[model samples]
Target: MKTILILYYSRHGSVSQMAQYIARGVESVPASEACLRSVPEISEVCEAVADTVPDSGAPYVTLDDLKTCDALALGSPGRFGNMAAPLKYFLEKTSSLWLSGTLMGKPAGVFTSTSSLHGGQESTLLSMMLPLLHHGMIISGLPYTEADLISTQSGGTPYGPSHVSGSDSARPLTDEEKRLCTALGKRLATLAHKL
Candidate 1:
């Protein structure tokens, strides 16, 4: 089976929920599977350390995971119109992968969760795409062909799938948002199979 590695960092769990929906979409494609991984939180107080494994949720991502995946779906909570630091920290370690062109020509998609409707959801998605573009990954986004793009009031973007979690960050994924996430996942997996 082809594996679509979903790597994300979520502070309030909304982005993680989005990842699950994407995973569902990936699994919908025959001969495709989702491999979910997460990055640990970064501490502001003199470099916080974490256990090798998280207490809950997916395990921390490794460079090997990026190297071996057939495709990738990257997600993160929006932070000032950019991705969270933990995910960026992980990506920074991938210079070796970039040099080796390990992810060159692989399919990739991006997703994000924002605290408000104007929380830079689109910009955050673009920010995450920068590194993937650097790796020579084929970036994928939701096409207008997905009806949800026209109807989604909560969170869905042509750049990728997104969610509006509200200031409290407790909002659940809307039906339209969920559908877009799944569609993006299916698109990534299908492209991986073809490419």
Candidate 2:
């Protein structure tokens, strides 16, 4: 079976839920599967180290996951219109993969969650795509054909799927957001199968 790596970092849990929805979409493809993983949180202290395994949620991702995946769906929380530090830190460690061209020609997509409707969700998705681009992966975005993209009032974008978690970070993913997430996963899986 083709494996699609769903890697993400979540703070208040919105991004994590989005990842799960995407994974469901990936697994919907008969010939494809999803490998869900996440990165450990970063500490404010420059020298602090996190546990090798996260206490809850997905295990910390490894370089092997990136090297072996048939496709990739990267997700993260929006931080000042960019990806969160934990996801960025993990990407920084992928220089070896980049040098070896391990992800070259692979299909990839990105997702994000924001605390507010205008809290930079699209920018965060775009920021996450930069590293994938540098790694030579083919980027995929939600096309207008998805229909939800044309009508979503909550959180869906041409860049990728997103959620508006509200200021308290308590808002759940809307039906439109969830459908878009699944669409992205299925889209990536289908593209990976074709490639």
Per residue, candidate 1 scores C-alpha lDDT tens digits across 1-195 of 899999999888999999999999999999999999999888788667578799999999999999899999999999999999999988998999999999999999999999999999999999999999999999999999999999988899999999999999998999999999999889999999999
How do the predictions measure up, each by TM-score? 0.98, 0.98
TM-score, prediction 1: 0.98
Tens-place lDDT per residue, model 2, 9-114, is: 9888999999999999999999899999998888888846589978898988999999999999999999999999988998998999988999999999999999
Q: For model 2, what is the alpha-carbon lDDT of residue 130? A: 96
TM-score, model 2 to reference = 0.98
Please, what is the whole-model Cα lDDT of each candidate in the order they appear? 0.95, 0.94
Model 2 lDDT at residue 104: 98
User: Quick one: RMSD of model 2?
Assistant: 0.8
